[model samples]
Target: MAVDPSDKKALNIAMRQKLFAVATSRDVAAFEELFRYYGPRVRAYMAKLSRDGQFAEELMQETMVAVWNKAAQYSPDKGNVSTWIFTIARNQRIDHWRKANRPDFDPNDPAFVPAEIKPADAAFDMNEDADRLHRAMETLPPEQLELLRLSFFEEASHGTISEKLGLPLGTVKSRIRLAFAKLRTALEDRS
Candidate 1:
């Protein structure tokens, strides 16, 4: 049966609601629909922002992986799916740029490795703890994740990330602070 276009908006709303519910429930088919729908758009967006075909394709995959992993937290009331998905793609591109441009550091430097951490116990499963941490990370807001990624992985100076992302430096700092606070709260009671 041919789908009518007259009620596209309503159809989109219903699809989003259903997809959001299914994704939250870990239904693979519903999540696949979202991936196929937005994957190309994300690739095109990253291509435009990066001006590199291969880089764009790579970042697109990264963004989609993040979306798959984080879909449960999506909220249609807070923002449309496109906006939320695009924001993730944009942040991934920014992160790629930052990593490509990070200053080279000497591997021989002793300070690069933490001294106090125990070497013998490093390989412990700690499966229960890790599962808890993953759940907490899943709960973080997109804005907070973006800020935290920029601050820690990109290591973009507050002024630079703010300028690059067109956000105020204070806002960037605030979001990173909040992201860390959330992580701390999530881990406070764990052993």
Candidate 2:
């Protein structure tokens, strides 16, 4: 059977949508289909990234497991299925690398670690600095403070904060910049 390219593309998208729905609903068949479709590709990608077939295979399995567990976190509006899957694969690879290279330490070895107590004066200075920063933050306008909170404390990108708050990107950036400048000046004066 000769299928047109457009038809193939449409079929792929349809299958992806169905797979997402099934995965979201915790269907074993859907997970099997997804694994069958993406497993080899993920393995190849991880192998290329890690340059080790055995580790890549392990990472691929872990990625698929993570996808199965986090399928419900997928949002079509954020990205497509391939991107979501690849992101998981990439994270699994990173995690595998971190685990493989982690250093083992013995808690009882005096030569393995050093504990230094902070001087009382240094602790008092740190507390004063924190209080000063808190007071400076309080001096910011409500809107600017909210932008700062979203950008720093919440660790959200400015674009995301803009979209979430229904504000323009430029406005969000400018507000955050202004807030930061105010904080810097206030903190420096106190110092």
Candidate 3:
């Protein structure tokens, strides 16, 4: 019986038979028909992914070659001919991108790391100054210290801090300013 034009299941069955012929007997005519039907659609998919017509055509050729070589491996139980062929095309695109994006150097190699210019001791005084600042921050009034923590540590905007603390924006700003002044005087005294 002839398959109705609207019957998708019949169409897939016919296509699967053609693919099976190619797989089992290496039927050149069946393969040629399959290629002609799928090539343009594969090319269109690749072009949409790569955004380059020439590159898409190259990838389509790769996909068809894979189809020819791997035809025997295809299983209709897993998917139909169209789905199998398109999966090959998608894999070809991913392989192409992976090769293109690979770095020339082994980034994890220690030989590739840049040498430090400063001696380790150079930052010791800077660490000491940070410790002094921390001590000064601990000495501030609780309200001023809280505002400074929200402003500097949390990186909250002054308006956000005001809203969060239920304080006016000006009050938040003034508290933070006073905290900074006290911290400066305290650090100076320690020096």
Question: TM-score of every model?
Answer: 0.49, 0.51, 0.53
Candidate 3 residue-wise lDDT, 70-140, digit = tens: 99999989988899999999999999999999978888688988877676677787888899988998999
Query: Per-residue lDDT for 32-78 in model 2, tens only?
Result: 87787789989999889879999889989999999888887777777
lDDT of each candidate versus the true structure? 0.78, 0.84, 0.89
- Candidate 3 — worst ten consecutive residues by lDDT sum? 1-10
Candidate maximizing TM-score: 3
- Return the number of clashes found in candidate 2: 0
Q: How accurate is candidate 1 locally (lDDT)?
A: 0.78
How far in Å is the alpha carbon of 30 misplaced in model 3? 0.5
Clashing pairs in 1: none
* Candidate with more favorable, higher TM-score: 1 or 2: 2
Of the pair 1 and 3, which is ahead by TM-score? 3
**Mind giving the per-residue lDDT tens digits that candidate 1 earns over 1-191?**
12243666664675576467556677777667667777888888888877889988898899888887877777878877778888889888788779989988987678786577545456455656788787778889988887777877788889988998899988888888888888889888564
Full ranking by TM-score: 3, 2, 1
